[model samples]
Target: MAVTPGEETLGSRYRSLRDLVLEELRDQIIERRLAPGERLVERDLAEVLDVSRIVVREAIQQLAAEGMVTVLPRRGAQVAALDPDSALHLFEVRIGLESMAATAAAERRTDVDLARLDRLIVEAQEATRAGDRKRATHLNMEFHEAVVDAAGNPLLGSIFRSLSGRALQLFRIGQDVDAHGLHHEHVELVAVLRAGDAERAGAMMAEHIAGSREGTIERVRQLVAEAEAREARG
Candidate 1:
């Protein structure tokens, strides 16, 4: 939905304002433009986004509900931190959901769906080779969503998408890693699915996700320690 001028100015159009704010914030969060645990001053965000305080508050509350932001008593809101424990917990949940989805998709795979997945895999590889991290990440998401869609389970797909958003946030906070390795994993996953090996495909999917979680957690821990030392020295 388009943001109306009146809604933008008055911030009374809760639905549109809420969605717009979320979209903007989601991009920032995913890109790590707004780093984890960074304070989100409503006044600063309102001024920067050209929205009202009401809109900012509503948007932040929605993000909090999504587990993307945290609201603290007397301290206001900040981007949610990606601690090691939380990362492991979220990845465990994701591995279970995605592995099941991959198994179901292998069993229910259609020729058309396979073709689309192949195309996405190729696109992701090309993006990675060209050093376009944003496009690569976008295609990575599309490939996974395609698998979930092929599973023909709307509930499962919805859950995967939500969890994937959180995972993407964790991924972004880590240093820029080349997508080439992940692209190869995607290719192998497609091969397993095409061969109709549900068990093997599920195992591969789980392993791939687990590897990503491990890499991201390690990076986050390093960054956290560096930040702490910097603060101590100051």
Candidate 2:
């Protein structure tokens, strides 16, 4: 039997709602509203978000696949804790991937792409100046994503997006180190891209990513040490 238009519309609406919920939940996690190791209760979340449990379940499943959440048998879902080893591994891959993206973007970017990149840089700078760490982090992702999108390779875009969830945690932590400096780095990278020097752009991006990884790992080590101190005191 052919599916009716009404059925398709209803399904579309449901999927849209699910996506909105998913995005909101992801933001909450990234901003630490839902902290690492925090348990998520479906009924509570569904009620709070004014959605059905099914929608919450589907959204959580997607987040899990993205490495933002961990679903354990019998224990349900919780935000994934940041692990230094995993973070290092992720950044190792990102350094290579993002350098390739920078090269492609330098070669392929159009005037429209440059305009978008400029706007995002301005927005990111404003967010940092306003001391809005969460917004700054969100804009940081947008700026990098804009660069990757300009690369014009569907497979590259897919791989970049896949790494984004885990990287969000690192970005959030790295902000405590220097949000201002990070925005400054973005500005410098934009200049390199505008100059259309693919080799320089790629090298700069690789170094930028490596620096971020080091900062995130340093923060993680401090956090672990603090936790250990509290345990020893107890």
Candidate 3:
């Protein structure tokens, strides 16, 4: 059968549905609702998400491509086990990217950019003080996004956005550690940005990202230990 122009085909609709399912599943994985090494059954996820098994299968394939899930021929799929070495590499990339962004922003940021950053800081502070870890984490991303935007480099922004999903997963893993402490760090970064010191701002950004890397690595180790302990008991 020939499809008419401007009409959405079944394939397109299914692809769209699959993307939604993929996003939801990624959220669960990042939020630890689907913990590391946990099995992912297509039927079970399909039932829970109220979607078809086909969509779940497609979504799982996408997740596997993103390095978030592992699919075995006989074992089906499971959330990828935590790899501290890979996490360290990603954090290193982030440090380089964010530091460059901060440096560029210091040189290029306008009054409006500074104002927006100030507002974000205040809102993030409120979220932290109110004990809203989720909102605070979101605001933290927004704050870095604003910095990158201020840099006014489309290519830099594109690269940062590409790495953000895994970065966000790390954020969610460490969300409970110290919202207030992180907010204060943001305050420091803002001050450097406000001073328009390119070198200092870049250094601050690198140091800030480096600070979080250890915590995330520790969390990964803890998860692995817990899993191992469970296996030993079993």
Candidate 4:
């Protein structure tokens, strides 16, 4: 529960303490700086962030509602563990939403959007080549998110925000997945986006997501089994 640098800077800039706390806590969970199933003590996090317990509790509750945190009767609130069923359900929703996002992005994307995509693709390639799975996974999440933002569909972005945390957690669990293949698919998606072929972009996004499912489901199952085994041991 260590406070990262620049948080005090954020406090100064943001007028809403609760919003800031929510953002920070959510980022920690998504980034796995806060590990899955780890207890989130309000007193501890509140002291760390120099905020009130009310604020931290509010943030945790919001995360709970988003399914990023789980609250048990006696266990309090801990980071949520990903289950294979949740991943499969999430894949179904992402397939529909992200494919729509790609199609809309292809129609609405500007030169600025393309520039950001190009930069991310290059960085992702570098991370993959270096075998930096953590950074590569983060960049992969960023790439899809950028396309959603570029789509100019506020509702779509809202839905993505709701799911992005668990989606990131799932990606992290797939650390052993082929990084090069993921980056290659990203490049292919960008090519379609660059050409503004809406239908092709949509189909490409669907296929890209399906490929990720294929690569990642086994790892998801493995993690689930490991977690269950650990619980059994206890």
| Best candidate according to TM-score | 2
Q: How well is each residue in 146-198 modelled by candidate 3, as lDDT tens digits?
A: 99989999999988876776778888777766766787888888888888899
Model 3's C-alpha root-mean-square deviation from the true structure amounts to 7.0
Q: Looking at model 4, how many pairs of residues clash?
A: 0
Q: Which segments of candidate 1 are over 4 A away from where they belong? A: 1-17, 173-178
Using Cα atoms with residue i matched to residue i, what is each candidate's TM-score against the true structure? 0.84, 0.86, 0.80, 0.84
Which candidate should be chosen as best, given lDDT against the real structure? Answer: 4
Tens digits of per-residue lDDT for model 2, 1-234: 111123233234555878877887887787667867779888878766667889889999999999989999999999887678888888898899989999999998888888998999899888878888888887888888889998899999999998897787688878775666776788888888888989999998998888777778988787667766776999
Worst 10 residues of 1 by lDDT: 1-10
TM-score winner between 2 and 4, please give it.
2
Q: Candidate 1 — what's its lDDT?
A: 0.80
What lDDT score goes with residue 14 in model 3? 50
* Candidate 1 displacement at residue 28 in angstroms: 1.6
Query: What TM-score does candidate 1 reach?
Result: 0.84
Per-residue lDDT of candidate 1, residues 22-127 (tens digit)? 7778778888777778888988888766778888898888788778899999999998876788878988987898899899988999999899999999888888
Q: lDDT of candidate 4?
A: 0.85
The residue-level lDDT of candidate 1 at 210 comes to 83
